[model samples]
Target: MTPLTVEVTSSTGSDHLLPSKDPWYTAPADFEASIPGTVLRIRTVPGQPTVFSNAAAAYHILYRTTGSRYQPTWAVTSLVIPKKPCVHSGYNALLSYQMAYNTPTIDRGPSYRIFEPPLPNNYGIPPGHQQFDIMLDRGWFVTIPDFEGPRAAFGASVQAGHATLDGIRAVLSLAGHPDIPLPSSADKFKYAMWGYSGGSIASEKAAELQVQYAPELARGFVGAALGGLVSNVGSLYTVTNKTPYMGNLVLILLGVMNEYPEVDTYLRSRLKTEGPQNATAFLKGRDMDSFQAFQTYAGQDIFEYFVGGEADLEACQALRKIKMVEWMLGYHGAPEVPLFVYKAIEDELTPIADTDAHMEHYKRFNVSVLYERNTVGGHISEIVNGQDRAIKWLASVFDSSYDKEGGIKTRDVTVDIYKPPIP
Candidate 1:
């Protein structure tokens, strides 16, 4: 198939097209015949003044990837080359910055809204773009994969990992593209991964699955930094149910259902059909963003929508399948590269114990891990407070300065002001 390229000088113009309407997102007739990570389509949306303003150039690659069930599929990743040369280690550094766009909505993916106007109160830039700006400012080329795949399987780990690893392959394959400037040789770049919350699901899964799924790219990876991880989906229900994050339960359910038809059939048969809070209503979350889901279903009981409530849902064989496959981390494999993981001790959305168990699982396999547990913040606050540390650790990883000699290292960070007052 011939590659398609569109030039845009402004965010609002005739060339602007949403992912849903864009033909470039469509896979060619024989895409499945190609190997995973094979570039199917390339759309060059040169950096505009308003969108990705910090980037010297940007391109979107539609590449072959595997779906949740290991079926052939395709995904798009947005790649940005920084204006400045690679100053770190005198070699190009590629940071796959996964965005925490937890929705199953394809249009809500970063590549779609990347050139659109920012939502209100977001400082005139789209959400998640700030992270791109920061990475670009550091002279590191960045790639953000729509790792959820064509179906937008939010909670499916295999699909996320495959798309991410394959996205890197797709990017590396573009080293000699005449239009976009990249190192002539792929080995000239050091790669790293960073993601938080929903994004962590992809980054962590990719790290664990790399050795087996994409062994060729494994040696190029320096490390991965994950924060506010959702290690166990089954365990998360207890913490988020009926809370402000209760809506996430719906999103996960719908997301998993998208990948596993059996789960969808099982859920459809058991969900309450009548009333405003029925299964049909919640399933609409497939098109809603994370914020919309939170606002629409906040403080609502998820079990109440089921025919047999929590008990019947627990007995579901379909749920069990995903619980073991897509919902849980470390079941597939362990990371070949070192890891820097951070989490809030009192995170409201995800349990810290889950991350602790996850880290131990990696440690059992001799995976280098540096775990930091912050005593003072919740899930949201830590994203800001831990930003500096995560970026610093990533920088160290890229520059070959991070220490990885010892076994798993754990640190407990407690601010003096957040400590309990003496009686």
Candidate 2:
């Protein structure tokens, strides 16, 4: 196969343009003709000094990928190559670390936030940058793809899956390239994926879809580590409706609307147009970050934004479209690789029962899984508490020491640091 040609763009200063303002993000006219994963553009970028102090270089790649409707589109992935040699014995290691940038805003992706001088309003560094630093410190290359795709379709699982896989493809294709700085042995890299919360949506979908959508790359994968898995999209309405996380409904609706036209029409027709907190005004206003969503819509009921209230929002035909495998987990297929799955029993956003059912579904298909149900902490706290174990599991896989013969295994544990005084 001929190596894909790369167009290198300059990035010399602190002023980094958002995807919307940068021409480098725009897909070329002939991009549709190229195969998925074809690298269309490349640019050298500054990695977060605090996060990538051990890294040799960082670059962003604009690559061809399929969108939510299976239409040809493009996505960007940020790659960080470490200065040290491989920590895993024989092969190079690559970890696709998906960030939980749960928002409808395209500009808030990791590719933009991974640089110095974090985005305004405490967007700070991307959610998993510290974890990326840990991976880099271990001498593993990390690819942070904007798996939500060009539309920033946050809940569109299929699009996220495609973008995640293609981002890996793009990275592997750039191996040994003089300008890109990838190690020559990148082709032999053992790949693993790690994600939590919204990030888990992409990692889980990519693991399931790899056998069908990108079968050629299946054998290269060691396994995937998913935490805080959202097993069913339909459950979100009941779980998050009037809670502090109620804003998730707005984000999911806006995101899915970008991918499904029917959903857009359905939501627009029903959205209240007169009030300060009306759905129409909120959706049409400035690009929204997840922080803004949480602050603005916290404790508000999502049903109130519609015409007939909860009944209308629930009865809409468009709801059925998103309930498919593309949005719902475990409906499409089982993961082909061994999985290290963990979740908090008290997860406020996603129901533990849904994850329980999801595990049962995968086990029935004979997929190798090591599931851990943490007795303490909720969705947010689990990210910090469960990460040490998750990373250890990933290390075992990359080093070819993980036991694939071990079938489904489940464990219940407590991961909280807080303890009550002796009774």
Candidate 3:
């Protein structure tokens, strides 16, 4: 097959691009690669929606490359916008598209995948599965924003969110072009956000910034679902001590701190001399094997290097004080749109209590709520199957259920005849 390439354009006319071949993972047999205008594109035809009448449209895959500063440099691929008839009118309405991160070879890093595609047929490496596919099945466009930017932007959740939201805008801008079809006369946009794990970080940051960063988007966003949320960095470190979850957490911390000085400073003070080297090694590798290496080399306990011995706890706290306040645990206001949160009761990776504290603030607001606690899945599993419930609930969000009192009326769990676990 001819190697596909997408020329990602900047706000200006300049371009830097990404090749369309799977950087790491194998492309399914049906993957169609096309370069639309300046953007490199891959698409799957719109299929029937299981619930709604609108044909579920898939990606008009798009990508952008940003330098280390995370500035937009070029449009690497054509924005792949999904198409389906609008619910309000028979005419086609433009929904958003998402790009997968950490999937390609050049984009891969030591500790992290650097947002490339999964290794071909490596079933153990998670990310591309149910929720991501289910969103496409339900008619929402999916763009896995390789948020690592052109340089493999990693740990830059806010930056990732911006690209994802902007990608949607780009798709809408293309909907009216002669080549694209409009399903009906009244096809305006309706959007909802969903992601788990690292993707959740991007989605949540986007939600916080929607009103301030992109008010135009704020009006169009119907709701968002965030699963396996990681709120406080310090709290996460504590959770990873004995649990295997520490590996990814370590890589994410190193990835972000290396790019951002404030975080780097925190790591330097907290970690022993070897901590920095360990971090670098971790970032270079993309899978669990590297995680085990970091764990083994650093000794059985990882917390002392992070939080410090009980004797040195005060010093660690002082160093944390010097770090950026917003980066630590910033205040994100109540979401203007409804929120759907799924958390695992036995999640070994992220602390559920931290999520609880954040939700407490949202509950006080007038926003509606649908909460589920799962018993079977871990972080990655919850992200995949959680969608089985989240998407259906999201469909109901479009339906009339909000009470006159501004609270969401109780709807069935939509899962089964049994109760959902509560953390």
For residues 314-386, write the lDDT of model 2, one tens digit per residue. Answer: 6877677677756678877988899999999998889999999889888788999999999998887788778
lDDT of 3: 0.46
The Cα error of candidate 2 at residue 77, in Å, is 0.3
What digit string (tens of lDDT, one per residue) describes model 3 on residues 10-123?
122212122333342222333323221123343332221222223233233443323334444333322223343225332222333232342212234211221233454222
User: Candidate 1: minimum summed lDDT over ten consecutive residues — where?
Assistant: 2-11
RMSD of 3: 9.1
TM-score ranking, best first: 2, 1, 3
lDDT of 2 at 109: 84
TM-score computed on alpha carbons, candidate 1: 0.92
TM-score of 3: 0.65
Ranking by lDDT: 2, 1, 3
Clash totals in order: 0, 0, 52
Root-mean-square deviation of every model = 4.2, 3.2, 9.1
- Residue 46, model 2: Cα distance from true site in angstroms: 5.1
C-alpha TM-score for every candidate: 0.92, 0.93, 0.65
**Segments in model 2 whose C-alpha atoms lie over 4 Å from true places:** 1-4, 46-51, 117-127, 284-286, 418-423
CA displacement after TM-score superposition, residue 157 of candidate 1 (Å): 1.0
